[model samples]
Target chain A: MSDLSVDLGFLKLKNPILAASGTFGYGLEFEPFLDLNRLGGFVVKGLYYGPREGNPPPRLVETPSGLINAIGLQGIGVEAFIAKVLPKLQALDTAVIVNVCGASEEEYVRVVEALDAEEGIAACEINISCPNVNKDGACPAFSPESTRAVVREVKRASRRPVIVKLSPNVTNIVEIALAAQEAGADAIALVNTFLAMAIDVETRRPKLGNVLGGLSGPAIKPIALRMVYQVASRVKVPVIGMGGIWSGADVLEFMIAGARAVQVGTANLVDPDACLRILGEVEDFCRRKGIERLEDIIATVKT
Target chain B: MFKDPEARIVGKESWGDYFLLTFDSPAVSALARPGQFLMIKVSDEPYPLLRRPLGIHSRKDKTLGVFFKVAGIGTALLARKTPGETLDLLGPLGKGFNIDPCLAGKPVLAVGGGRGIAPLYFLAWELRALGASIKILYGGRTQADLPLADKLRAEGFDFACSTDDGTVGRRGLVTELMEDEIKAGGGSPPALVCACGPDPMLQAVALIARDKRLPAELSLESRMGCGFGACWGCVQRIRRDGKAEWIKICEDGPVFPAESVVWEKESP
Candidate 1:
């Protein structure tokens, strides 16, 4: 069997398939669907210092081969996750990555600090690029300065390896990735959903309650691949590519484009067994190509 | 427990815009309960990314049925399926109706509206088998929408229907027929009220159940991303342990106690 394992420098995964944050919930929710041990890892839903009620209804809309959502990062808070969720997750064989989120920089550090005290957390994905919240202003990832500041602070507060998840809604995504890398980010995850909106013609109103949401699915795959290629070529840290990944071929394409690993986002919402299915496809492709180590393909794309 | 499997279509029936497709999916069918639903992949392609959530309409042995109307692109695609086609389905997901033993030998009211009538047929059949006397109240916009009325009656189910245009059993809302039934019963009113329909109709049923002091259960509808708990796309404001909170409709319930539901118009 072809080895599907991928090492992200600071964190080593059994395979390259990870259920993305916000899409996978707490990992416990998917216990009935598939074995968590079979997956490389899964990033849990975003958590703040305290519980959040999230945005109002009409939070999702389906576009052509895509879904736009503005869930506003509703969560049970970091402490609650530690108290309730982490213990259950400690039993699982898969890596548990906690996605840390906050409205302000201090809140981000606070969440990371809380998580730093806990065991069983493989890594912390610092989410400074969530497009659904901070409606009037740009997210931290929008600017290299803010991105650097937040990533540096989170890295300082977090003992676990920090993965800066970057947003695509930027002029220079590579600059942002470099800033995160400079600020001590161990890895980079790109690109968070593209900022998008849809309108209802009959009602003359926005489809989502938050007005705008992050668009993910097959619709954004090509652009995500390009961004991953650009940032991966520039940044020294490992890049976790995601956006519109639907199949095993899609996973290999991202790795070839320069991503060390890949996260399965919108596909999880559509197909519950997407992680394993995509993993199977990856194995089958490797077997067909007579490849032994999956890592041999990372950043091997021809210009 | 739920199963994600490609179920072969064993039966297919169409009545205008409404269609019923039965599948030989033993894994999901054997676990089917009234008010539960299936996340059906309507297309083989990725044009429609999310699966359509359809309620379990009927179950017999290793087969389960789903009845839906051609309301949107997803349902429209589902309606075009043939008897031999295989459907990728995830089910039977979510908490179904609470079949209390206390309901046995008791009078139960099953209210439905439009395609919302999908799960009520299965619910009534189960209630009847449990020795409870079941009365179904089905309503639609017109005669064409009440496609299951004749079939349900043919199966020896006690049924009543209503249409907005007055082309069917009653000229008013199905809630009106329910009120009439309750009023006609005089001293022997229904012990429980169960409803699945449009939000407004469900609200009306909740109000009716409240005024009559009867226990009620309502199957709600929401635009769902995942028919499981992952996406947190479909949420409803519900009161749990005397405190109001947003609950995942896909997992916490597609079925919930009437009193716990906080309606859309109501302030939290």
Candidate 2:
């Protein structure tokens, strides 16, 4: 049998597959389908400083091979999550990574400091892709310079390993990956959902309530792979690649493109046991190739 | 709770733009209740990737019925599927109706308009077994939209229908028909009203249920990613204790009390 264990520089995972944020809900929601412990890790929904009602209704709509969503980070605040949800998630055998989002750098620090003192947090995936809110004569730091600033502040406040989730909306992803590495991010996870929209011809209106939404599914997989390959080859830190990843073959493709680990997002919506099934396929591929370790495929892109 | 079960189609019926896909799924049928939905994989094709959410229309013995309209690519794919072909599905998901036994003697009004009437078919059957009298008041844009009147009557359900253009039945809205019934009441309001339909119709139904001081449950709709509560994709606004709160249409409900829904705001 091949070893699937992955040490993401700072945080260690038994395997490389983890449920992407928002799509998987809390770990308990999928308990009826599969044992949560069977997967390598699970990231809870994006946690913010205050409780958000999220974007208005019609926040999601089905596209050809993707889901367009503008669920603007609706969630239970950090305090409630720590009190009600954290204990149960902590009991699970898999690594529990909290996906944290904020409107500003100060807000990010507040959430990070709170989680920093908490137990059982394997890491924090900083969602820099969240629509940045800046009024101080500056654009939000998803830009290379801006990203370095937030990553530095968040890295100092967070006790757990920090994985800066990169948005694909940026012009040059490699520059941002390098910026995160320079700011001392433990790892980088690319690429967040691509911003896209669909229109309702009959209504003469956009399908989503927010007008624009982040697109995820098999439709975005190729773009995600290309971004992962570009950033992974350039950055020194480990890269956690995710964007419409569905199967074990997709995982291998990401790994071959230099992704140290992967997070499954939209595929979980189609099948709850997607992580387990993909793991099975990965193991099957490993067995067939006589490959002994998962790390062997990292950046081993045949192309 | 079988994970992903392959449902063998036992029957298929074509009614205008609607299609009834009945599958031999004993495990799902045994657990299905009114208001719950099943996510059916349309095909192995990658374009229309997500499974479509069809409300369980009827479940007899080992067979479960899914009545749907060909809305877009996903449902059109489902419409082409034939009997004897197995479909991959995840089932009996979300909170169904809370039909209490105390309301058995009272009449249960099942309201549906157009393709929204699909799930109400199964709900009528279940309500009958529970000893609750069933009255179906379905409406459609035209005569062609009214598909369930005959089936409901054949099952001995007290079925009536209305059409906007007055093609058949009453020449008015189904909500108007319901208002007349409420005005022509016996002693108290009928047990409870369970409804599924377009948002505007449901909003009118909510208003009717509210004015009559009757208990009402609405089978809501939204864009669903994973029908199993994972994506948190489908959400609608509902009032709890005079305060408005947002709830997942896929998780918290595809059904909620009529008054609980804040019909003032448009739902996705």
Candidate 3:
């Protein structure tokens, strides 16, 4: 059997397939369907400084090969996550990472501080790409400078490794990735949903309650791959690539594009078993290619 | 917990605008309980990236039945499926009706509106086999929508129906038909009321259950992302123990105690 394990510098994974945050809830809900210990690891839904009620109803819309949602990062806050969720997640045999979102720089650092001393958390995936909530009407991930500032602060405060979740909405994503890497980010998770919107011509109403949402699915795969290639080539830190990854080939493509590991996002929504299934498919591909380990092909791209 | 397995289509039957799909899926069928649902991948294509949630209609041995209406691109694709074609389905997800907690010698009241009546058929069928008294109240916008009327009658079920246009059964809301049934029972109704349908109608029924202090349960619907608890995209405001919490409709329930639902914040 081909070795699917990979050491991502800051974190070691049994495999390279991690369930994306927001798509995996707090990780307990999928205990029935998902054997958490069997996979690489799972990231829980994004958390905030306080409980967020989220956007109004009709927060989701489906596009051709994609889904756009404005869930607005509704979470139980950092404290509650540590109290009610972490204890159980700590028992899992896989990585238990928390995706934290904030409305401001201070909010972001505060959450990092809370998780810094917390136990069982493998790392903190600082979210700055949420389209639902913006501070001063600007999404932090949109500006490379803002992205660097937030990552630097969180990296300084965080006891564990920090992964700065980047946005696909930016024009020059490479610059943003470089900024985060220079700011002391241990790693970077690319393409946190593309900013998009849908409309209902019949009622002339926006499909999502928050008007716009992050678009993810097969529709964004090509775009995400391009961005991953761009950022991975420029940034020194390990890259966590995610976007419309539905197949084993897609996972392999992301890794060859220079991602140390990949997160299965929208595919999990289509099939909760997508992660494991994709992992199986990856193993099959590696076996057929006569490759012994994923590291052999990890970012081994050719002209 | 859920499983994604390829289920072969056994048959497809149409009742007006509704399509009743039967799949020869033993595992999902065996695990089936009324009020439980499955996420059906309508097509192999990528455009409609998410699965459509459909409640189980029947489980005759290893065959599973799903009754649904064509409401969007996903359902439209589902309606086009032919017998012998295979479908990838993830199911028997979500918390179904906890009938055991309320079954104690009390009869069951199953209320539904249009396709909302779909899941209730299986629910009533189960209770009937247990020798429990079952009364079904099926409602719709008009006669064209109440196609399940004759089928419910043919099953030897106690049927009470209403149509908004007064073209069939009683005229007015389903809550009125339920009130009439309650009056016919001499003010002592069934032990439990289980309902499914559009939000407005379910809310109205929930209000009646509240006013009468009748123990009721409802199968709620929301535009779902993942038909599991992960996304928390399909959430409903519910009041429990005097506190309000947003419960994921796909996980916490497609079925919840009727009184627990708070229709005030209808949008969230």
Candidate 4:
């Protein structure tokens, strides 16, 4: 059998499929359907310094091939996650990547420091692109200097490898990817959801309660694949590509476009077992192609 | 809850812009109760990102039926689905209506307006079998808007109807008819009042019921993401200990005591 194992610098995955942050709702929610240990790893929901109630109603809106959500990073916060959620998550066999979101760089450092001391956290996925909240005049992930600063601060504060998540709603993703890498990020996950909005024409009002939301789904695959290809080629750190990934075919497209791993987001909303199904399909495709190692396909750009 | 091993579009029927699609999900049927809903993924596309929250119309052996009005692109696509097609479906989720056993033999009234009648059908059907006197009061914009009147009549239910255009049994809102019935029945409230419909109508009914100190239950509708409680998208404002509290409709209830709801305020 070909090796599906991938060395993401400090982290190792038995397979290249990991559940995207927020979509999986921690690993335990899916326990009733499948064995968590059988998958590569799971990313927990976005974490803040304190518990967050998140945005108002209509936080999610549906698009033609994807969904836009302004969830405003609703979560139990880092302390609660570590105290209540982490113990249960740590018991699982798969790697646990905590997704951290903060209003400012200092808050991000505080969250990273707490998770860094935790026993089971394999890595930290720095979320700098969340469009749900309004905080600083600028988001650290949006600017090269700010992205580098946050990455450097977290890397300095935490012992675990930091995977900076980049926003897709940027002019050039390669610059941000390179900036995070230059700031000592061990790896990077791109792209976070895109900024989007929907209006109820009859009511003449926005569909989502938050008015603006982050768009993710099959509609974003092509753009995400392109971004992954560009960033993967530009950055030296491993890149985790995600946007509307639904099937094994999509996984292959992302890998071949230059992603070390792919994260499945909105598909989980469609089918709770989507992650497992994608994993099975990937393995089946590998077996059918007589391909031994899944890593061989990463960055296989067609000339 | 048993896992819904498969999701196949077993039945599809269209009525104007509305479509009724039946999915074969034994897990949902086995665990489904009245007033609960399922999170349906209408298309694999991302335009309509979140799953559509659909009320369970009926559940037979291994299949669950959902009735949807084509309000948006998702429902429009759902309306065009053919049988033998497959769509992804998540649950028989959220808390449904509560049937008080103590009021089993007592008279009960069910109020529905437009598509609100969807859940009431199951409630009336189940109550009738339990030997309860079920009186159904339904209303709509016009005669054609009432989809299941014939079925309810055929079920031998003592039901009254109303339409805004005066083309039906009575002119004006269904709440007006409910008030008339309560007056004719000696001013004492029915054993219980269960209602589901437009918020304005429900608010009116809730006001009258609360004034009379009548025990009433209402089924609320909200746009939802994950039908499971994990999303917390479907929340309603309720009064707890004299303070307003946010209750998850997906978990706490699609059903709530009439007084528990903050009728004039938007959901939190």
TM-score against truth, every candidate: 0.98, 0.96, 0.93, 0.91
lDDT head-to-head 1 vs 3, winner: 1
Q: Which consecutive 10 residues in model 2 chain A have the weakest lDDT in total? A: A132-141
In candidate 4 the C-alpha lDDT for residue B91 amounts to 70
Q: Can you list the residue pairs that collide in candidate 1?
A: A217-A244
Docking class of 1: medium
- Among incorrect, acceptable, medium and high, the docking class of model 4 is acceptable
> What fraction of the reference interface contacts is present in each model, in order?
0.77, 0.71, 0.78, 0.46
Query: Across residues A1-303, which tens digit of lDDT does each residue of candidate 4 receive?
Result: 668887787888999989888887766777766788877898888899998877777677766777778777767789988888899988889988999988888999999988877898889999888877864213677889989988988889988888999888878888988899999998989988888889999999999878777888888889998999999988888999899898899999999998998898877766677889998899999999999989999999886
What TM-score would chain B receive for each of the candidates shown?
0.97, 0.95, 0.95, 0.92
How many backbone clashes does every candidate have?
Answer: 1, 2, 5, 19
- What TM-score does prediction 4 earn? 0.91
**Candidate 1 local lDDT, A1-303, one digit each (tens):** 998899988888999999999999899988888899999999999999999988887889999999999888888999999999999999999889999998999999999999888889999999999998887426999999999999988877877899999999999999899989999999999989999999999999999988988899999999999999999999888999999899999999999999999999998888777899999999999999999999999999988
Local error of candidate 2 at residue A222 (angstroms):
1.9
Instruction: Summarize candidate 4's per-residue lDDT along B1-268 as a digit string, tens digits.
Output: 3345358889977666656788788766888888888777766645566677777887767888887778877787777777888767767777777777776777898999888887887788778777888899999888877767777798789999999998877998999988888887785469989999888888888988877778899998887766665555566777777876556677677888888888555422
Error of 4 at B179 (Å): 3.0
Q: Per-residue error at B78 for model 2, in Å?
A: 0.8
Question: What TM-score does the first chain of candidate 2 have?
Answer: 0.96
Report the lDDT tens digits of candidate 1 across residue range B1-268.
Answer: 5655678899999999889999899888878899999999988778887899999999999999999989889998998889888899888899999998788998999999999999988999899989999999999889999998889899988888999999988899999998999998789888889999999999999998898898999999888999888888888889989998778899989999999999879622
Interface RMSD of each: 1.1, 1.5, 1.5, 2.8
